[model samples]
Target: MAIRRALISVSDKTGIVEFARELAAAGVQIISTGGTHSLLEKEGIPVIGISEVTGFPEIMDGRVKTLHPAVHSGLLAVRDNEEHQRAIRELGLDYIDLVVVNLYPFAATIAKPDVTYEDAIENIDIGGPTMLRSAAKNHAFVTVVVDAADYEGVLGEIKQGGDTSLDTRKRLAAKVFRHTGAYDALIGDYLSKLGGDPLPERYTVTYEKVQDLRYGENPHQRAAFYRRPLASEGNVTTAEQLHGKELSYNNINDANAALAIVKEFSEPAVVAVKHMNPCGVGVGADIHEAYQKAYAADPTSIFGGIVAANRMIGEETAQLLSEIFLEIILAPDYTPEALDILSRKKNIRLLRTGELASAEGRKSDWVVTSVEGGMVVQESDVHSISEADLKVVTERQPTAEEMKQLLFGWKVVKHVKSNAILLAKDDRTVGVGAGQMNRVGAARIAIEQAGEQAKGAALASDAFFPMGDTVELAAKAGITAIIQPGGSIKDEESIRAANEHGIAMVFTGVRHFKH
Candidate 1:
């Protein structure tokens, strides 16, 4: 179809002037609503107001502007159908060939801390979505444009071929539907929150396509990355890739896990992650020593895992990390020599996650998981258990050194799966039993893995022990003090077992269930 009429309405007016000028030069009539019409008129572009087409002035706070039949009829009219063409001519409606519309800034508005509920509701664009969906529905006859970034390419294609291609129209139509759907999802989520529903009446998620991966978890499976609608200001996903090969699916997953753990520390720290679990984590006076201690803690597991450092990667630290076969290394900055040495590795993925720590006192959002037909969403387990939060439940209290081991084990236990138990001594994890069928099984596996190291080590459980058997087994393995989230009904029996074994026990009141 030849370009004839173009309808333009947008809250974001970037590049609109030049786009309007080019369309006018090509003999295309421009019809726009309130703000867009005024903008085009100021630039000396001949433009007809939407009110002129609809025979009604914009009413009710401009909400009733483009919802009329004339606007949609022109967009939906089938060029080759006699009945459709007859109805348009009989109703005195002009055929609209192109629609350039972008919705209001609902996401940006809601991001403000002091934004009122009424202000957010007012920014919701009803007419824009209506026009976009109508034009997209008739994409065979009308081309729809939602993003300003697509304007240049579309205009270039139209200028080269004297008309937009049918394939281009259809592809743009799909983008239009996705755009409107995302907008609706945001609105629904906000309304659901206001109504105090635990879960949204409908799932409203928006993701922007990031990249096409080489493959998924396996080579045969296809994969691509789509980021959440709003980019987290200083998150790993928004990090810059300084050098190295493109990240694989598993690399991104492990890198994210490493960042999550490293973000917990305020001091100079380094964390090595393997298979979504931390192999080693250390805090030191300098990043070099932190990386050294972390690597030495579990040299075997750090072989091909992801490494994340809270501080910048120095040349000395980079030299130590280069000795290992790591899949990815991430930090805020890298020294020139450090980047040079790390770049020598052909397949290592290096990322510069500027400021990996969350802003002061900012709470991290919940992580949501989807399974089968249901969704699970809960607050992030980023809250650290402080010494003040631990309450001694048994007759004996934990000694000073055992308290440090208890805190270290508590941090490690949060990353493990449910029915999880971790045994640690002197800030190093001795053994871990994660995702077992029962708590007793978890305790047995942890103790067996620890072997002789289980003696005098402190234990941490993600949740309360339902029975006394776990404590009995821990005592048999020579455990000293245990820390757990105590809320079970049989908690008294577990406390009695700990007292009988002269093992100090503390309840944190908070659970760190990872499943």
Candidate 2:
């Protein structure tokens, strides 16, 4: 069948007029609906309204316009089948060769803080998806286009060859399915929030293909980046690269972890992450001082690690960072001099993530992990565990300085993978034990790393101690006080151990398990 009819309807009218004019020059009849029709008419292009073709007026504020059998029959009819041609001839339906559509702004509408329930419900599109599905199903005869970005490619193909190839149509059909799947997932997420369901009865996720990476965790495995289904304006997916080489899989992972930890501090702060764990973190008067202190905390572990700063990168900070072999460095902005200095290192991945602190509030959901065939999801360990939330379980209460260190350690430990332990003194990390098999083993590693520093340092655990062994180990390590989420069945035994060792202990009602 020769391409003759094209349907054009879109919310994002970015270059639609030129695209439609090109189709018209190719002798394709343009059929559009409501606002799109008016926009095309204003451009002096002849466009037939869907109501005229269907012989029915748009009812219910134009919601009932394109849902008619005539609209779908044209898109679904096969050009090569005699029976389909016969039915189209009998029903007097014109063949629709292409469909151009972008759904309503449901995600954007619901994202607004002042959006009402009724407003969000109305933004949920129905006819757009119906037409898209019909055009996608009959890809042999119809071409489907969802995003405006595809307009140029589709027009290029049609201009080069009189019609789009079968391969292009098949690829566009797959994109249409993905488009509808993502749209539905956004709706499900919205409804789930209005109601009180943490997880939908069935899980549906949508991801748009962003780019293929150099490799996965290792160079041998394949990898790619996908944006979250209904992500807000600014996220890791939307970050910009001011300069430097492309990011690897581990670089993105460690950068994300570092960014999450840096956002927790309201003041000038720096966090260094290695292997998806915070190796060094510090807050100070200036970004330069913060970087120096964070680097000094553990210079050995900071090697080849990802560093995140909450403030602009100064020349001094950049010079300090340039001295090390760093994998990635992210900050709100880099001074021109700082960029010039850092750009000298060609392989370093420098990303300007521009005030993504606002994006942190949008992520309250859990981190998900997939196994051989099943998956598990839990809430993110971002809950602010305040000192007031602690219930001094042991007879001895933490001293003023110990309580401050306990709070500092608690904040840092939340970003570590469980079973995790963090030892800190004077609001700086002395040692970290992350992703250990058991709690006691993690405690031992933390103390061993701290060495003599453990004598005055306080320890923070991500979860409740199952047994008293971890508490006993902390006592033997000379830890002055300990803070953990106390919810074990043997909570009394752990408390007894802390008291027996004369160590101050506080039980925070909240747990900060990261894994």
Candidate 3:
């Protein structure tokens, strides 16, 4: 097929003028609609108005333009079919060999701080996607273009020959559908969210590629990072990497885990994470104190771990952090001296999430995990509890200091894997046992890690103890107070064990289970 006629309509008029000029210079007739026509006329280029092609003026504010039978017949007609050509001839329709179109600025419009719902709904383009899809469906005969960056190459191919190659047309056609599909998915998601249904009957999400990682979990696997457009503030994807080498798969996962833990605290806090679990967490009067306490909590696991802080990092804290080998340091911001000192470590990833780190939460409360054939989507474990929410169910009441430590411990335990136990002292985690097979085993690991520190520490369990065995072991380790959901069938036995050991037991009535 020869490139005798081209349709040009675009919301983003980046290189359309030059592209259209080249097309016209190549003796290809240009047909455009609305703003594109005015632009081409003002640029002194000979172009046919869309009204002339459709034989009808645009109505309903140009929304009905190019949606008539003339445009569809030209795009859908099979060039080599005698019957189709006869129908075209009888209907007085000509072939549109090329289509260059892009959808409206729906994504950017919705991202604005104060955009109205009417404005966002009005920006959805109906005719543009229909035209693109029509042209793409007949890709064997029609050449479609959606991206501005492809203008030069596409024009080169057309200039070299009379028409684009079949391979190029197929590739561009695939791109057109993907572009239009993503556009429709965005609109659907926006409307579904406005409908106030968190889990609709059908859910669709689209992401843009951020970068290709060095590798996945292992050297043999390939991986790339994709982030949702318009992600909420203070997200790991939204964090700025100021210095260091590119992030690895494990680095991003560990960093995200650290961020989740740090986001739970409003005051100065630090969380050191390893293998997608928090090894140490601490909250203090200042960042330096918090960092020191976190480092002291688990010195062995702190090596080459990801550290997230909710406050600005300064020179003093940087000096302490420089003593250890950490894979990453994420904070709200960094002082000049702190950045200078940390940037020297060429392989350490430094992430700045801005002030939102102090108050930022996830965009949605949904967590999705893949299984063999499908995914299981459930609400995220964002359950929170206050001091007032804790019910003292045992004879012994926790001291004010113990209450603070238990709250801090509760925050950290939620982020740990199931069968999790965290021993906290002085608002810092003395030890954490995660992903164990049984409650007693998890308690033993936590107690052994805490060692002498477990004597007066507060133990926080992600779920109720299946039996009194965990409490018996905690009593032997001298754990003074305990926090658990207290919903187990053996809850009475566990409460009796707490009373016998003179331990303070509080029931949260809420469980935080992370697998």
Give the number of the best model, judged by TM-score. Answer: 3
Candidates sorted by TM-score, best first = 3, 2, 1
241-332, model 3: which lDDT tens digit per residue?
99988899989889889988898898899999999999888889999999999999999999999999999999999988988899999999
Compute each candidate's TM-score over C-alphas: 0.89, 0.92, 0.96
- Model 1: per-residue Cα lDDT over 1-515, one tens digit each: 78889999999999999998999988889999888889999999999998888999999989899999999899888889999999988988888899999999999998788999999989999999999999999998888999889889889977887678889999999999989988888788777877877365556667777899999989999998777766664466788888888888888888888887777767787888888877777767889977876776667778999999989998898999888898899998898999999999888888988876532345757578889988888766668867998999999999999998898788778887778998887666777787888989988988887789899999999999998999999999999999999999999999999999999999999888876
Model 2: ten consecutive residues of lowest lDDT:
357-366
Worst 10 residues of 1 by lDDT: 357-366
* Candidate with better lDDT, 1 vs 2: 2
- What overall lDDT, based on C-alpha atoms, would model 3 receive against the true structure? 0.92
TM-score pick, better of 1 and 2: 2
Those runs of model 1 whose alpha carbons end farther than 4 Å from true positions after fitting are: 38-44, 59-62, 160-162, 335-337, 357-364, 438-453, 466-469, 487-497
